[model samples]
Target: MTERLMNTLETPCLIIDAQRMDRNIQVMADMARNHQVNLRPHAKTHKIPAIALQQIEAGAVGITVAKIAEAEVMAAHGIRDIFIAYPLVTASKIERAIRLSQRIELIVGVDSLAGAQLLEQIAGRHGHSLQVRLEIDTGLRRTGVLYDQAAALAAEIAGMPHLRLTGIYTFRGSLLAGKPTLDIAAAGKEEGTLMVQLAERLRAQGIAISDVSVGSTPTAAYAAAVEGVTEVRPGTYVFHDRMQARLGACDLEDCAGSVLVTVVSRPSAELAIVDGGSKTFATDIQPGTEPLQLRGFGHILELEDATLARLTEEHGMIELGPQAQAANLRIGDKLRIIPNHICSTVNLHNHVVMQRDQAYKRLPVLARGMLE
Candidate 1:
């Protein structure tokens, strides 16, 4: 059967274009290889072993996860090297981390001495050493230590008998405030350079800094050029969302994923409701950028372009201009939506159907809701 024929069998399901996905992966991999930076794409985007293996085969050094359960899923699939970008503090989670370290080469992020001490004790009791990376709060004031304090944390981790200081990592996501693509890139490069400088300072202070990881899809293209950054861990680039497009980091054509929903009802002359609501397209809003007023949860892809629109729980409210609304959009017709944030929308589904021209396949979202 043709791909469209098969797609009719799966309604309200995510359909991934395999060819497009492969192309996106190759583009990023080629970029990293050409720039001579290690590529460790975050697996949290797809959260499927099949996609993860595809990335690995395309030359990913390893995979980055946000939770211990995600690491466990990746490890079960024989992903030998995994890095949990977030810090693990609880005793049960620390024990789980220690156990996972025995099976795979694991690296956990640390920002505090207390967290380091807890992990060190767990590693000591388990008779195995843990690899720890100090997270530097370059610009994103999330879960990272200040650059000056990074060296101190590195020193503490280095002194712990059961923990080994491997490198420094940072997420330059704070650069995505507006459409300042060049400014964001410059800021990211500066932050990465400072991170490398701090790493060098740690080395001079008798601390061994092996890896310097920096990433943010908005900043990946430029951050890779930073001198001291050894690896780039961009995750959202794989599925370029509307936000990425607005930031000029990717073209709309580079978006490989979309929500397939049917027009359910048109109760007014100026508005139409789509079957996809908050449950399908997610309620995440993309901030407006000059030259493009983005005011909704997603952009409706027209034949040649797209328009911004809002989403409700069970319906999508699209405000159509006179010429745009005049186009005959009958009930039961399907439309594709480029989500504002691909990662958040993806986590809402259980499986993603794959298609390319006339071929079709189905893949389970193996790591959905593994956020513990």
Candidate 2:
């Protein structure tokens, strides 16, 4: 019989079951391969180089990072292909980008002519050409140039010396919340279609838009169906969070990452305190028009069905549900918590403990707190 793995961890530690993680990785890889789309998982979900290597070895084309420092870290770990999926500007930053290009294939997102020009100058000075993706504001409205202006921006990026306009990218994270009945798949398809239309318009204007990347765990399933999208960059699909769960992207059992906490005190009949707090969990609430008011930082996993009842910063309060609470839970009893946002929660810890049955090992979060 296989030994239970949770018995070995200390409180307030992030524990990842290796088997579960491999399954998640394989599921996404198979999905992308079967659908004929490139899998470039966002490394921001788990900054560990070992995990990133596992993803690459499992058939991911490359890795995605949100910051220059993260790219630097991954590059040090020998990850040769990286996509910085955020709009970047600044002489110093562009210089760093140019240097990174020398070490690995680098792709940065650009939404404005000014940003593109800066990158162009840096690349020119370094005697290097850089790959860039024009971001389109496809209803998300957080970043990217206006969809109508995408062609113009592409033209500018294409005209710049030492800079190549690779394609376009967008985040459908905005669609993850709202009435559970909302069809995010349809919204994702529409967003992708709009991006493809813009890319086609750019091509008509004599600009070569070679790649179109669209992603969000909620919409990745349908994103692959978008006619013109060449690659899907869904990060959270590897470790489904509470938001992903609510969006119907993954069942609770599919969540591979959780915070291990020990019950410290039962302050009141309605309140119980755990060792994990904001320091362990993250402050990022769910995304939507009326976001789910997550009461605490993270949710307590009810073992029977992996349901979470309530959350607080330092304490995860459980509302006794139909299934009896595990009688094994007592003072000092360790419980696993499914975080609201796996990416941010993972960012909080410097290391993650990997468990397989009765054996446990530690892996450095290698790129933790690399916010630059």
TM-score of each: 0.93, 0.91
What TM-score should be assigned to candidate 2? 0.91
| Worst ten in a row by lDDT for model 2 | 173-182
Q: Write the per-residue lDDT of candidate 1 for residues 1-372, one digit (tens) a residue.
A: 243653475456676777778888998899889879899989888898778888989999999999999999988988988999998999899999888988888999988998888988888888888998988887556788876777767887899998888888988753443333445577667757877889889899988898989877777767888887789898888878877787777888888888877777878766667777788875555436443346677767772332436666767776667765767677776777778888888888898877777766778889989989
In model 2, what lDDT does residue 31 have? 82
Which one is best on TM-score?
Answer: 1
Estimate the overall C-alpha local distance difference test score of candidate 1.
Answer: 0.79
| lDDT score at residue 257, model 2, on the 0-100 scale | 85
Task: Please give the RMSD to the true structure for each candidate, in Å.
Answer: 2.4, 2.9
